[model samples]
Target: MYIDASLFMGMHAAVPGTRQACASFFAEHLRDRVWMTYEEVGRCDDVVWALPRDTQDAYYPFMDVLHSTMPVKRVPYTEDAWKTAADLPGRGVLSLRERLLMATVIASDSRLVTVNPRLLNLADQGLPVAAPENSDGRHGAFPEPLAGLYRTSLALEIDHARI
Candidate 1:
């Protein structure tokens, strides 16, 4: 299971109680299965780069923990993926990175777990997409914890092109 930057940020910035909850959740639930993408780790690296030297020093340990604990899979952006992305309807509006990410997911035939569902809705252009069950705002109940984990893992696999 690979995690997106949103989930990483959520883990990083969650409130005390939430952080503990997440820590407990992850420790008890995802130790062996969870994975992260090089892109997502790169996003975290971008955050580190944006910080001041002293701040970076202070946060290095945490970053190390994230690095050592979560395996990061490096997936290249292939030519076919790029070509497919170019044909997407919102290609002009989407950022290059976003397009590559979306293409990577589609080409891999993996599920995507994004807060933005609209991007996935543009399936007319041939992008294979999936989102959390309740994300459409139609489901009344929250998904089961394991189900959420599975969804997250699926997203990661997509992002990492492991599928």
Candidate 2:
């Protein structure tokens, strides 16, 4: 599954129970290989660096621990994914990064785990999207046929005609 930046941000924002929720979610799901777009990585960095010095100092070490323990594979934005992003439904509502992240998950044949309501709504449009575990230890419903991990890497297709 592709992890959204919001989940990572939640780990350090000090929201009530959010840190524990995100941590538990990561601890359970990140046991296997997971996917993350490079954009999400950058977004996480930017958001973390913008926090107060004390938060930054604490969050960086936590991020380091996650990096050491979890197997997160960062994928680059591909041309095919970009095209799909441009054509995503509700394009007017999502920001460019959100669209690209959604498209990357689609092109890779992977599911997205996000808390964003707008992105979660895309599940109805045939895009595989789910939410992280809630405070009550309940997981969000994953859209059918996409609950399982399909690929280890981004599945980009090449068009010979375009070459």
Candidate 3:
């Protein structure tokens, strides 16, 4: 599953529960490995770099350790993904970052996991997406309902392109 920036930001949240939830999400997905696009990763890095110098110094090591210890799988932002981002089927609704992220998701054939209402709306429209929420407030596993949704969405995109 693809990890979105929101969830990624949650990992560093000051709220203990939020941090733990993000940690639990990573632990649960360790075996399968969590995927993230290069752009998203850079965005996270930028968040860190934008912090006060002392904070950056303090968190840099922590961030390094986390990256080294986590089960993260980096997804390259390839030309195909760039092209897809340029013409993503969001009808001018999605922001550049969202389109880039979605394009990478499509290029990698991975389901996106996010809390963004806009992206979730796309998921509601049948794109493969899963929220990291369950009744107990822990990270939920990938939903079976989203299994082939990405392919279906792609088919629709293709059909629409033909028109």
Candidate 4:
């Protein structure tokens, strides 16, 4: 799974439940050995947004421990990856960071592991979505009741949201 920045942020959340949820999610899925961009892995390193305390001293050490502990395969932002990011399938709506992340996943031919709703929308288009909440994972299957799913509200919404 291409691990997202949000999942990493969740691991360090002040809320015990959120922290545990992230941890458990990783524990269950990371045996496949996850991949993440250096940007994603480092997104929280210098930021003060979610930390309980933000200081230069605190920040450096936090980054150190996180780097040493996590077994993520940090993918480089290569030239082709950048080109792919420039024009990913879903645009206008998806953020740059999300595009870059997905680009790397596409280049690597791996499933994206994200909780971002925008990406989840992509999952609904057949990319596949999974987390602890869904009892493993669910295929973005064609509903039997749809008769022809192209007429469903979700399909219409996904079409409308397309770049």
> What CA root-mean-square deviation does each model show from the true structure?
9.5, 12.3, 12.7, 13.8
What is the lDDT ranking, best to worst? 2, 3, 4, 1
Model 4, global lDDT: 0.56
Error of 4 at 25 (Å): 1.7
Give the TM-score of each candidate: 0.55, 0.76, 0.70, 0.62
lDDT of 1 by residue, 1-163 (tens): 3345544443333243323333343444334444445676687567556656665665565545544554545567777778877766675666676667776766666644443334546554565543323323232211354334433332111121111
Candidate 1 wrongly placed segments (more than 4 Å): 13-29, 32-39, 116-163
- Candidate 4, residues 1-163, lDDT tens digits: the string is 6777666555445554544565456544533577788887667453433334433443444434444444678887777778878766678888887787777777777777555568778776665344435345431222233213212221111111111
Q: Once model 2 is optimally superposed onto the true structure by TM-score, how far is the C-alpha of residue 17 displaced, in angstroms?
A: 4.9
In the range 1-163, model 3's lDDT, one tens digit per residue, is: 8997667666555555554565457546645678888877887776666667766665555455456655788877788888878766776788888888888887778789875657778886777777665448645432322323312221111111111
On lDDT, the stronger of 1 and 3 is 3
Poorest 10 consecutive residues by lDDT, candidate 2: 149-158
lDDT of 2 by residue, 29-129 (tens): 65578888888888777665655776566445556656666799988999989888878898688888889899888888889987666888998888899
Candidate 2 residue runs with Cα over 4 Å from true position: 135-163
lDDT score of residue 106 within candidate 2: 88
Residue 84: error of model 3 in Å?
3.0
Q: How many pairs of residues in model 3 come into backbone collision?
A: 0
Q: Rank the candidates by TM-score, best first.
A: 2, 3, 4, 1
State the local distance difference test value for candidate 1. 0.48
lDDT of 2 at 122: 91
